[model samples]
Target: MTIKSGIICYIIGIASAIAQPNPDRPDLCQGAYFTEEEGAKALQTFASTYHDKASWEARASLIRKGIREGMQLPARPQFAPLKPIRHSLRTMDGYTVENVAFESLPGLFVTGNLYRPINATGKAAGILCPHGHAPNQDARFLEQAQQRCATLARMGAVVFVYDMLGYGDSKQCDHKISKALTLQALNGIRSLDFLTSLPEVDTTRIGVSGESGGGTQTFLLTALDSRVKVSVPVVMVSSYFFGGCVCESGMPIHKRPTHQASNVELAALAAPRPMLLISDGKDWTRHTPEVEFPYVQNIYGYYGAKDRVKNVHLPNEGHDYGPSKRAAAYRFLAEYLKLDLNRVLKDGKIDETPNKILTPTDLQVFTSEHPRPADAVVGDEAVLALLN
Candidate 1:
């Protein structure tokens, strides 16, 4: 049988044994679905089927539709007025941090920190920093997350580091709710809108980067939004590993009766645009240099823009967005987004010493003194009701 047919049978066998879909186990397929050699062969088969730009674009269009339908996202509502609240503007050595929050929908709030270069000129490049699934789903307060955003700000970019759904101060719904993917995607899109809306941001020089589950968000947003000129999805793109979180694979985006695709394909949809795939040896992306990277590079080749895509494989590292992974992403963003690299570079290494990492409470958008808005949706059922 063909690879797709065989995989379908495997999935069917698993589903039949369960009798009902497990809400806790949303991923129909994980990284172990194929061995290394099998994944390579599967990618080759998919790539060989698309011979021209038209064919690839046709496939991309279908994948995009599937993603929307699977997520149960309706026609996007009119742009909600971004009622932004900014506080605690602290100026550091080369950059400044401000706690900010804005509404993505009527009552759904997105919260996090915004970092900007102290000496930015006319229109600075904009970068969106989405954090992965940490222990508490904390957004920007993690040292690594703060370090990356602060370093980027020091390098002369306007970076907005926002919370994922039910993370940090966005506690309107549970993090693992069925619609997590839909809400997070919507929040990312709105974050882009909020970023570009800034008078200091250059709309054409926008980029998005995130690691792990956030990496899933990075590519998904880039696939749906053309405004993101560059993408760096770190440690989460795989041919067989359709993400493990409800926020990643909770929906049926990767499979349908007649159509099948993978995160490798979703990521490649950002082709012709600059992209950097950061993979590590211990994660699902360990095979990226062999399987995923080449598959995407092949798509970039179709547009005669092969050089725009790159992969930096850390064969010694694990899944987290550690220091070395951040360095690779830093160089790519500096090169593609036209940010000054020297500010964060010391002896050819990233120097995050200039960043002043704050405690989580410092970045909190709502506290006892500043209460969550009276209109904020509170329970899982209430939040899900908004989508319906």
Candidate 2:
């Protein structure tokens, strides 16, 4: 069943009232808070508030400020040097993969693999690949993640596939911290710092793509950072559904006493920039074509760049970054980032056969030989202390 359609039904089944936030609690918009009718009405109310570019930008500024303050982000966040550690270069079909780790904060390590073209000669586009809450913590090791990164590298873009907080080698603390949303956003910025630091990377041609929770990360990062030139968030944008995880909506980014927001508005913050929304019939994003897309397109209309924001809806597909989803992302990224899609095409079709799938052990960044830093903080409380 589609998420929004069943929200009230599910609540009734549990003998509970409709989902509503208690006034005493922080106004965190989670899961399906609105039915189709309510969501459309909310969009209408939002639209009526902003008539043109000037008003929309003013609203956008408030939304951005709400996000920063809600997340309790520092007025001036000090960034430490991303002391990177790299090794394990494995050459495959048209790309080379290297296991990498870098400090996003003092003693906090972000781990992943860096994929690059086998023989890159000039400035190439850089793509950041973040994963959702897949079965195992080792999301970057998943077949779909590997396939997309390798395919993009083969297409001549340097790709970095990194782990979310408690996933894979980023195990210094649990992923359920109160500040989970804040840390993940910071990690994304640092990932860009690391990606652009490469001598071969083109700073002007940066892009990001992911699915599910990763999709939430993709648009959130793109909205906050101007460096992201292209964004393809798969199966995660919804007007009624604010992400279910602490990492996505743990903070009060969507609601405060003075203002309110939704993922539809947040995603639209990528105004005039190239953004592709990938949705399916089985999840919260099922209403994309009707409910969300039109609202975002209207925002883009203010910039006279409505064509830049596009939606690819799959009525037959569910929520996953499978081959079909990857194909759509590939086409969009290539068109905007100037990547060579022909390299991954065979028989005039996208072929992912060239991407190598490796075991979790093979992609692990911390081992006995290359241990995690001794000074790394442990547990949720200790990590929170560092933020203070």
Candidate 3:
């Protein structure tokens, strides 16, 4: 087919896919809250409300409030004292990985691995690495996740790779249950607190990045928390698709009676602050360059930080946190967080070989021998009650 014909066929296929529902996975490209046309119009309407910095701040405040109310977030609780527990500390070529766990809520434990440079002297920059829904049923132990964290750490940033609710060691609740949006957002905030609490971490230099579903978490946290100085949400943010997963759009975040917003607006709330939107042609983000990027760039323009915002669209790549995606994020983070990129680069390319990808068992924070904490919330009901 000719390029023009190919583009036409792709649009026709998407329309057909939208018309037919897949019983096995109903939410795929569902665009439940708004159609592509409607979403585009909504973004335009939201952007129209902001002209100057003062107007943009007012709009941002309204959007943030809408998110909190729509997600049904409870009062911000004192981040339960980060009684962090560190298990295995494995030293790598230029960094080290510490198997770590901490409580985001009273009984809800957030688990993951913390990576740090071995030759650190004073305070260092910090990065939060949330993972996409990969390894299918399991979310951790992905080589890509490990490699990114390792590379960032070797380049002088303390990185934390955390589990998403039920994934990995955080098996207290099911991944698809209700209140996930609220719980995960809280966990992210607590994760930020944990990262910054470390005396070795500089408070001003902090960042968050993730792909796919994790990208949802990345922007959500960045939108809600000002502590996140830099953000790179990959293969996710789309003007059309709010997010297929419940965790991303399960709540009423996109639909308030008085106002409506999409992930694009949620992401744009990180305006003026440095952010990198990485999209690929194989997924919903295919139109990001033409659609989402311009909308967000206009928002940054309000603060005169348009140059600080960037969009790296890969027409040939698919919807995964592959090497190219990580490279874009690595360069952005290195520049924004002031990390030593030279340490992670060789021959003008990121060297992934330095990372020692550990097995899932090796990275788990709660195992049979170590056992989950006695106070850890046991089932979904119990965990949900904590939020209620």
Candidate 4:
């Protein structure tokens, strides 16, 4: 019943996340398995047995990876903080917008766009928009979210889109790796907080979905915040074992050390909650059924939501989400979180046809209202105060 066992999962480096039977003898990443039983246990161990700052401090590789490769933000004393501001858009349907700004870490910030759903007379479904590993570089963020938002807007759901820390306008003017990642998650969580705070948002109906690095953020944020009702982690999840010591060298999301909860355990967290895992039927990385499918399925089985868990395999598609692929993702969300299955389900959205997603536009989300320096460390205190 434990998620980790004093193991090598993210929270704890117990190393037991994988059953390292012959550690002294041999067997490294190649021999590891990421199952709910093992992963959940590992996570639990990290929380209970490995609550030492020294344990985290000793992992220099992890700390450096956290600081250099990704976005960071200052932490809020509250779980996370989200604010609502008014907005007007031409493309957006309902356009009940808000300007959400909060302190992620101490000196870091994560802020960006927020698009509300249409027909929101009362509390409505909410979502967090975390961008990809490299923002505009990823098609899903470049066009997918905007499309999805409009699609949902048409259906009358409240959606929020915020740039991931370091990806959009959310980058820190300071440099602190560990704190940055922590606040990045906090940023997403804060967005969730803001959603619940809204009189128009249905806190219980909130959902989160992300592609690539955003996919990782989806899982991590959902896992930490129980308030997130539904989630779809696309193009990334289980199969890490494959990318790690298998067919290819593990160039993981954010290039972290890769000992977090595997996709298997990640799915398990969605137990009763609805979860959608989208993968390119023809993925470039080792995210195929032979690699990660079984582990994720196993996690779902543990939840008794094996039926609730689903994956839309896009045939011959590389790493990106198109209208067709995105449709499948939306269906899963509408069915589980929105309860609008009858109205929101679109047939061609999840088309299995292999098509490239929209290329990102060269538009920047941050503006002078809250500007940042070119190369700020995530941990800088001054950098953290910009959004606040």
- For each candidate, the alpha-carbon lDDT, in order, equals 0.83, 0.85, 0.83, 0.50
Model 3 is weakest, by summed lDDT over 10 consecutive residues, at 20-29
Clashing pairs in 1: none
Worst 10 residues of 1 by lDDT: 1-10
Q: Model 2 misses residue 241 by how many Å?
A: 0.5
Task: Highest lDDT: give the candidate number.
Answer: 2
Residue-level lDDT of model 4, residues 1-388, one tens digit each, is: 0122101112221122243322442222322344434534544543342323344333323533342333333333443232233322333333444444444433344455556554556566777766454313222245456666555654556777676544555545321232444546566776776667768777778888876556767876776577988888776664433122111112222234444433444444555577777776433223445445554454455445668767677756645555665777777777766545444444733322221222223233445643453433454455445434
lDDT of 2 by residue, 147-231 (tens): 9999999999999999999999999888878899998988898999999999999999999998877888998889889999999
Give the range of the ten consecutive residues with the poorest summed lDDT in model 2: 8-17
TM-score of each: 0.91, 0.94, 0.91, 0.64
Which one is best on TM-score? 2
Q: Is candidate 2 or candidate 3 better by lDDT?
A: 2
In model 4, which runs have C-alpha deviations exceeding 4 angstroms? 1-91, 94-99, 135-141, 174-179, 241-261, 281-291, 339-388
lDDT of 1 by residue, 1-388 (tens): 1234323433432343234234454444443455557666777777776798999998888888888887776676544689998888889989999889888877888898999999787789999999777654564577778889999999999999998887888888898887898888889989998999999999999999998778999999999899999999988898766676678877787766557778899999898999999997866688888889888998999899999999999998666777888989999999999999998878987898878888887888898877888988889999887776
